[model samples]
Target: MRVLAAMSGGVDSAVAAARAVEAGHDVVGVHLALSRAGGTLRAGSRGCCTIEDALDARRAADRLGIPFYVWDFSERFREDVIADFVAEYQAGRTPNPCMRCNEKIKFAALLERALELGFDAVCTGHYALLVDGPDGRELHRASDAAKDQSYVLGVLTAEQLAHTYFPLGDTPSKALVRAEAAERGLTVAQKPDSHDICFIPDGDTRGWLADKVGAERGQILDRAGDVIGTHEGAHAFTVGQRRGLSIGTPAADGKPRFVLEVRPVSNTVVVGPKEALATAEISGIRATWTGAPPAAEEFDCHVQIRAHSDPVSARAQWRSGGVTVVPDAPFDGVAPGQTAVLYLGTRVLGQFTVDATVSAVAVDA
Candidate 1:
């Protein structure tokens, strides 16, 4: 089998590419230049697609004795991930750029180009499993539950899964992958894993949004529709956010306040008690299935709203092109523009971007 190993210049990806070569497949290592920020080097494991990262990926490929190349996809990334991120926030919604990258750039664009170039599969270092199910290949959690990345990959379509390959899915831990890289004489063995969003170098999301969309001072409304405080821009806020809101005044109940809603139309930031973030229902859009869409119109399933949050029990109602999930109990922080991945046991049934939420507690605008 001819495979294109998508090396991310990290220990996990180096070991994954080595494993792919060890499996007797014809493999080629390819580093994606997604950032293309004047070829600057990444510092402290914060930036992705930096010149240093590309060099590290090349070094790993040389150690593995495979052909290596860098594929530039910065324009696509800016349009699909970065631009979409700013747009979503400007519209008073929270967007997950990592999920967007997987959906648009990695799995979709790269996979398509790989197929066109006569590659049988596009391999990555993602910690997620592909198991044969009753219907076809089904995605599952990795052996290392803590490092499972199946959530971000929830936006993958059935066609994308047909050619997707995760070589590190069954690895017990990331440490072991680094150890394997050491054994294979790869240089990325001790490279620190990136934790922050790639584009936000300093990790100041509010500041970045502020720079993008200039400050527009607006009223911060209480639950009773009365102005409590003022904020620079509503685009800098997301539903359920607690910190960074300089509300100036505390809630009458003396409890910590949370952002209940961000109204872009009214240019208002609504703040109330943290309990106001609790939601009972979530409506999702742009649903994509890993394999086949469920034939049943409605069913009980596990819904994962956040990447690291535990999957909550939910009753899902399948709509024409999307699904509405009602949690068995109240769920907090059901933010819009986030992916809601659905699962039936360990198998990923599908996922959709959250567009609307119905909180258990009523919130005022």
Candidate 2:
């Protein structure tokens, strides 16, 4: 089988590419150039696709004795991931760009391009499994729970899963992946993981957004609608954010308040007690199923609200062009725009982009 190994100039992808070569597949390494600016360097090890990174990927390809090319996916990435990110926040939703990248760029555009080039699959270093199940290809959690990336990859459709390859899914740990790179004579074995967004290497999301969209002065309001303080911008605050509220109106209990809502219309930020963030039900938009969409309208399953969040037992129902999730108990911080990945045991049933959440108060009402 011919495979396009996405070498991200990191330990994981370097090892994954090596593993593909060891598997006797005709593999070629390609590092994606995601950023538009060529001169700007990545701040520390927090960014991806920088010139240094491309060099690192090239070195890995040389060590493996495989041909490598730097593919420019910058325009597509900007339009799909970065632009959509700003728009989502502007609309008062906390969007996950990584999820968007996986959904739109990697699995969709990259996979399509790979197939056009006659590659059987596009391989990545994502910590998730692709199981050749009794029915067909199925996505599952990685063997190493600590590095499981199934949550973000929930957006993958059945077709994408069929052409996707995660070679590091069965690895015991990230430590072992680095070790494998060392044994394979790869130099990225000691490189740090890129923790920040590829575009914003410093991780200053607020500063980045402020530069794109002017930071509008907004009112910070309490539940009663009384203005307790002021904020830099509604886009700067996300649901469940605790710090930077700067509310001068001290809470009666002296406890810190959390962000409850970001009203884009009136440019207001709502703050309340943490208890207000406890939600009982979450509903999602644009649902995509991996195996089969559930037969029953409502069924028992586990729904993960965030990428790093724990999967909570919930009751899911297909309705109103979305999937409504009713947790077995109250769960906190079910924010809009986060993908709700559905799971049954180890198999990923499907995923939904969280559009709305019913708070515990709303549930009781």
Highest-scoring model, lDDT? 2
- lDDT of residue 240 for candidate 2: 94
Q: Please list the residue runs of candidate 2 whose C-alpha ends up more than 4 Å from where it truly belongs after superposition.
A: 362-365
RMSD in Å for all candidates: 1.4, 1.5
In model 2, state the lDDT of residue 152: 88
Q: How well does each candidate superpose onto the true structure, as a TM-score? A: 0.97, 0.97
Count of backbone clashes, every candidate in sequence:
0, 0
Q: Look at candidate 2 and give me any clashing residue pairs.
A: none
lDDT of 1 by residue, 187-263 (tens): 89999888778888668888998898777989898888899889988998888888888877777678898888899
Q: Which stretches of candidate 1 lie above 4 Å from their native place?
A: 363-365
